[model samples]
Every structure is written in C-alpha cells, then in structure tokens.
Target: MRSLMCLLFLVIFCSVQMTSSANLAIEVANSNCCGVFSNKKIPVNKVVSYYKTSSICARRAIVFKTIAGREFCINPETSWVRSHVDIVDKRTATPP
Candidate 1:
C-alpha cells in the first residue's frame, strides 16, 4: 500500500512537470508573430499576452515558416503544419 501511494505521487508530480514545460513552450510560441489559425497577422505583444492568460500548452516548439509567401505554424515535435492541417506538407512554392 505504501509503495502504491508513492508511485501515485510520483506519477502526479511528473505529469505536472511535463504539463508546465509544455505550457512554457506554448508561452514562447504564442509570443511569436504567427497566429494560431495560420492566416491572421497577430501582433507579437498580443500573442505574448495570449499565452500568459491561458493554461493550455503546446506540446512542441512552435515555428513560423513562410512558404509560398504565406505564414504557417510548424510544430516540430509532431511535424504538423497549421496551414495545411497536415503533419508534413512539402513546400509547394518558394518561401517568401
């Protein structure tokens, strides 16, 4: 019983740490120039505020790539591209 309790505590602690780390990464990501939907031009300052006000976290480092003269959110961990809603989209056109 004692070992089970210890294991439970360890799991909870690790989970919280992972969640907070992800949140921090999201905070950094939202501070960037790209918008969440991949189409809007949001102010950097506003983006910074967005992350601070929310508890949601991004699982990976967020990236902004300009492909074909358009902006996109590239989540490196999952290799997802916001513009195409696909895990990986080859740059169809030259980046601007």
Candidate 2:
C-alpha cells in the first residue's frame, strides 16, 4: 500500500511538472522571439503552426513553428500574425 501511494504521488507530481513546463514555454514564447527567421511563412492551420518558447533572445517577437517543423521568431505586430490571430479568435469564440 505504501509503495502504491508513492507511485501515485510520483505520477501526480510528474503530471503537474509537465503541465507547468508547457505553460511556462507558452508564456516565454508569447513574450520572446527566436534567434532566426524562416524564409517561408506557415499557415495558421498547419500542424506545426503553434507558438513555442524561443530558444534565443529576440525583441518583440514570438517563436512560430511551421508545419514543416521549422522554427522562427515572427513579429506579432505584423499584419499576417495579427490577421491570423483575429481569425482564430473569431473561430474559437463562443457563439451568441
């Protein structure tokens, strides 16, 4: 019984750690930029089209991952990113 309790505790702790790590990564990605930029732009719906923590320090940027597994920092102020964000927001918003 004691061993089983220890195992359960370990599992819970690991799960919490993983969740926090992912959250931290997202926060960092939203606030930072990547070290390099990709030559091609990825659509927002792509599989790799998600924000991630930038591996490098950049100013006013968020790391973007393309469907092709490429990573780069893009300026959120750009019309492209802004427009996509709007679209996503609209799609995800609760319907009246």
Could you say which candidate leads in lDDT?
A: 2
Clashes of 2: 0
Query: Which regions of candidate 2 deviate over 4 angstroms?
Result: 1-33, 47-57, 65-71
Task: State TM-scores per candidate.
Answer: 0.33, 0.40
Flag regions of model 1 displaced more than 4 Å.
33-96
Which is the leading candidate under TM-score? 2
Question: Taking the tens digit of each residue's C-alpha lDDT, what string does model 2 give over 1-96?
Answer: 999999999999999999989987777766545555555555777624445444445455656655578666666666687766566567567899
Once model 2 is optimally superposed onto the true structure by TM-score, how far is the C-alpha of residue 81 displaced, in angstroms? 1.6
At residue 24, give the lDDT of candidate 1: 77
- Global Cα RMSD, each model: 11.9, 10.0
